[model samples]
Target: MSQSPTLEEELERARDLSVSDLADAIESIGFECTRCGACCTGHGPEADREPHTATVFPDEVRELQAATADHAGDETGDAGDETDGAGRDEDAPADASTEWRDVARPMPYGLTDGDDGPEGETFEWALQTDACGDCVFYEETETDGETTGACSVHADRPLICETYPFSVALDGTSQPMGEAVDSVTLPARGDADEAGDAAETVRAHECEGLGRDISRADAEELAAALKERAVRELTEAVGVRDTYEPARPGPGEVVVHDSEGAKRPDGTSVDD
Candidate 1:
């Protein structure tokens, strides 16, 4: 007898859906700019330092240069200096200003050995910073040059800035605010002063494009791409999982419990 379609095939079919099939769809769909400047400001200099501290991907560095060229003025040559005028050695190869191959070390994920280990490493991540709570690339401008300010690098900003409120990790997966304790808050809307509860905002804006909320159909497309990549990884790339079993808890050893009875390693019990 013939067999039904495989799970992959079914998943593919699900992905073929349209924009309407997604639950967390964006509502008004306005260009993102709360003038909050959260993306610009970071912690301290050590937190936002260059070289070993903050490394930009070759592509992003190029984009940053292009976007801020006009604003950089006489600081043009300073851009090529990896230190970005921080006084680091200018003779380094990584500081040579390669158009695209300039990869920074201390990247997000540590390198995994090819054969005997897990899958490939995750991508590197870095935060944007400047003197204030705004990014160096961030430009604040008003309609008549009399108003307050806003981000100038909105359009060509990195994936991080473009997908604020919803944060994407080193891995490709994205998480909403409530789901994560460390997520950045979404910008406040209208006279509704206080920002919504993290979880509430996440739930409310599930499909809002500004929050990196892709439609179910879009998710399907991405899933398909991932599936293909997975197959390749299993066959060609390094496999992440290793089967060596971990030592199981011994029989009499007191196990930690969340409810009712809790006990010490020596077997003394405590009440809820």
Candidate 2:
């Protein structure tokens, strides 16, 4: 059997990818989001009851927290109350205790569901889910009996969300992270498959917009984001490999191994 690529090799491969070629492949396959919410819901037409789970970087988590807090402040200001009447600054930074949990939770892949809750060691963070198993930030609207779904934190959404349905074929990394719902395989270079020497391929995943026409500009923009995501993912993988340390937690406690190090579900660092 062939050996798996090392983290360093994967990082080099990610860095060496050609963004222009990726754009060409994307332009060839084409895409336009249909706003169906399949990517954000637990029960969209193309999805099952599994809650949406996407890897979120620590910085992305902080960005979401700040965005949420800013939105809350805006709402508070609109209510015509800038102070608690006790002369407290209503615009103060959000309390990490309350806001952080709402933004992200421990990535549940390596955890086990226990009687008390999930317990075990997991790797990375995932967007928090609502009671229905949908992403907490997912929202739906009805207009004249037509329903459409959207992300409440769309602008600040993580790179995983931005580069959905598009991933590159690289050893030691899975960008979309699952079986392709629908896909168009575009070779990274010229056709040389019969000789078993073809380059990597750009993969398109499940989405209603797969075959839709896309302008070159939009395709390039998406390509750029996809390249950025690929690099970030591999970089993070290297960090995790370098910093990993086994953790032992009692039942109902969870340990998350992220690029930074192990952490509790609350985003607090776990003492070594």
Candidate 3:
């Protein structure tokens, strides 16, 4: 197996690439999403919108916060809450909760291909659609004089968007499963026209690296490496683990101790 780069390394590589370069890299990989809406529709049975999984940029977070704030006016500013006219941030912690942390949470359950059912169905963590199942960011556009609707958040779209034509399942291990379509997969539209021709060209470029089938072993290895990197980066980014205080056991709360040593919080330190 080939060596997988650590998350830090990947981040560094990302940082090094210019915007144009980044776009070029994605193109070279054979991903040419035509905004056909398939990715946003049920067509993506195992789609996720998590920032980590979707390559969310720092600016996207800031923009989202700003846009949501502007739209709400006087509602509430929070994950799903609307902003209120009072200018107060609705996402602020109330008198009861612990201090709020700024880091994004781990990617939630659904958003990917898996065998789990009902109780395990995962959903992406982003602006949800009303009844349409479309992304809140999905947009339709028209030429200059006409108002064109489009995902305002497209530029900084999630990591999942970048790694498309391939599915990475982050269960116990990171595994790359073969997507239903590769470059070889013919576009549903007949390939007679220029658009179809271009689509075919894009497909050929993307499938070059992927070995026809998704290898479970490769997926697990990649997942494990990413998990390690994520854990380390998260700990550093949040600095929460370093400051976390283990809960004090209540009375009669049996504390498991090893044969080598034991200690209690009541001013006692014992070593075997």
Candidate 4:
């Protein structure tokens, strides 16, 4: 059997990818977010009611924490009495102590959902989810009697979120990780049928906006981000492999493995 490519090999492949070529592929298969929130919520008809899980880097988690704290501070700036006319403190200060748990949780991939909670060692972090299994940062706004879904932390969202529905076919890196509920297969590259080779390296997952017309500038921008994501993912995989160490946790306890090393679900160092 063929052995899987090493992380370093994958990283090299990622670096060698041509951003211009990726842009051409993206332009060939266009996309534009319809803001349907299907990607952020579990309840969409095409979602299969599964929680949205996007890999987030440790630095991205910290960035999200900072963003949330700043937003809380803005909402609580000195404006007047905290109480409303009804004498209720409806405008009380928002919790500014945004912890790691507030922004992300251990990705559930290698964990087991026990009676107490998820138990086992997982890799990386995922954005927090609401009780409804929707992204915690996902919100809906009603304007002109039309409701549109939006992300509260869109500016600080993780790379996976930024490059949704688009993933590079590279080893040691799986963006849009799970089996896509729906996807668009691009045309064969060169003479794929004659050569028995796979199609293009760019894969487009489920999105209502797929097949729409995309401007050259937008396609190029997306391609750049996609390339960055591919490189980062492979780099992170190498880090994880180099730093990985076995851990033992009691029942109901969960450990997470990331590029930084092992950590508890709360983002605390495992040694702590």
Candidate 1 runs further than 4 Å off? 1-18, 21-24, 28-33, 43-58, 70-122, 131-134, 140-149, 167-171, 174-272
Structure candidate 4, residue pairs in collision: none
Cα-lDDT of candidate 1: 0.35
Give lDDT tens digits, candidate 4, residues 178-239. 44443334455454476454443788887888888989999888888888898999899889
> In candidate 2, what are the lDDT values of residues 44-68, reduced to their tens digit?
3545467778878888999998788
Instruction: List the candidate numbers ranked by lDDT, top first.
Output: 4, 2, 1, 3
Error of 3 at 45 (Å): 8.6
Which stretches of candidate 3 lie above 4 Å from their native place? Answer: 1-5, 16-33, 44-62, 71-106, 110-129, 139-149, 152-272
- In model 1, what lDDT does residue 215 have? 48
Number of clashing residue pairs, candidate 4: 0
Pairing residues by index, what is the TM-score of model 3?
0.34
**How high is the lDDT of residue 235 in model 4?**
92
Pairs of residues at least 3 apart in sequence or in different chains that clash in candidate 2: none
lDDT of 3 by residue, 1-272 (tens): 44554444433432332333223323333333445544443223346432222222233434555554444433434444543445445566443221111212212343233344222212112333423555555667767756443554555444444344443221111222223443332232342363322221112223334443334444333334333433333323333223333333343321212111222211122232
TM-score result, candidate 1: 0.34
For candidate 2, the TM-score is 0.87
For model 4, the stretches where C-alpha displacement exceeds 4 angstroms are: 1-3, 43-48, 78-96, 177-200
In model 2, how large is the Cα lDDT of residue 220? 89
